[model samples]
Target: MNRRTLIIVTAVVAVGLFAIGGLLYSPTSKEVAVTKPVSNEAPLVRPHSPVFGAKDAPVTIVEFFDPACEACRAFHPVVKKILSEFQGKVRVVLRYTAFHPPSEEAIRILEAARLQGKFEVVLERLLETQPRWAPHGRPADSAWSLLDGTGLDVERARRDAKLPGIVAVLNQDTADVKNVGVTGTPTFFVNGKPLLDFGAQQLLDLVEAEVASN
Candidate 1:
């Protein structure tokens, strides 16, 4: 081949290789921003949302949860398992999506428990006893009696549940649930990517992928 022709071919090959490299490159978590999917707003993590695990963890699992949801109750342990598996690398931010009529009261109980630093404990108890209180197509019989040994001050929590601050939190979470387009309980987003497949294994795999990317 002529010298000029060889040089031209080499330049073309190099350009092609560079373009292929760019196409093959996958963005890491640090390179991407986790925002609301439709509106392209800021990160979905709200300052007032109840978070589980390291507050500064690199991976975030945002769960739009309804306290009266049986699926949320079922998936509670699955989420805990993911936290246990990831340790300090992942955290869960729970937003109240109260689809059921009784869920607001249940959330009030939880938020009040949060104020008293008993969020996790109270949550476990509520879920553990959920079936008794929350039957499908009906209001929860009432969760107050179920808090018997969960270390929450029932009387004080009842009063605190009525607080304007607590009510505001509930209001904001309800608004966010609508704004974010969460139609059901236990809808999960891993680093802003929705879990469309919707299963325990799928959730675990998504978390694993995000953690590895980070």
Candidate 2:
């Protein structure tokens, strides 16, 4: 081969290897999810689960997610996009599956935000600043500071987060998570059907199909 051709070939191979290495080391690659056929819908939604769309929407996406989960953080935008595309026809119900130790604290903060009717705002702030607080195995203590300008009364949220009611919400969701056979974060259920073939496209397709059927 000519010197120029060999150089180009080497560069292309390097790029390909780099891309492959990125995929292998990505946080999503380490996520372990186990989904069983959902025959019962009762455990999917509770009255207190955070809902992020029209309450009467025909299609429901129940997401069991951990706030500190990297995979869940990565999929946040995808979930938002789906909600936007299916506006008024689809709703997202957030189920806190606090798989990470730090996740319970985040979930408590979210539950507190929900009390002040600022769930979505606080949720967006947390996800946007996830890397700062939640860095893999480390504790997400910095997550509290990231919510400063989200209009959530931090003092009040702190107090409310310890309430029995808040604990009840967490406990109930934990039980439902086990009942529904969810073993990981970002597990989605579209119209009571589990997304067995997992992927962003698969989730979108499932939502689209449910929306069309309804």
What lDDT does the true structure give each of the candidates?
0.75, 0.77
lDDT of 1 by residue, 26-139 (tens): 111111122444334233567888899999898999988888876576556567767888999999998887888778999999999999999999999988888778877556
RMSD of 1: 16.6
Clashes in predicted model 2: 0
Q: For all candidates, what are the clash counts?
A: 0, 0
Error of 1 at 61 (Å): 0.2
Top-scoring candidate (TM-score): 2
Off by over 4 Å in 1: 1-43, 137-140
What lDDT does candidate 1 reach at residue 121?
A: 94
Which 10 consecutive positions of candidate 2 have the poorest summed lDDT? 22-31
lDDT of 1: 0.75
Clashing pairs in 2: none
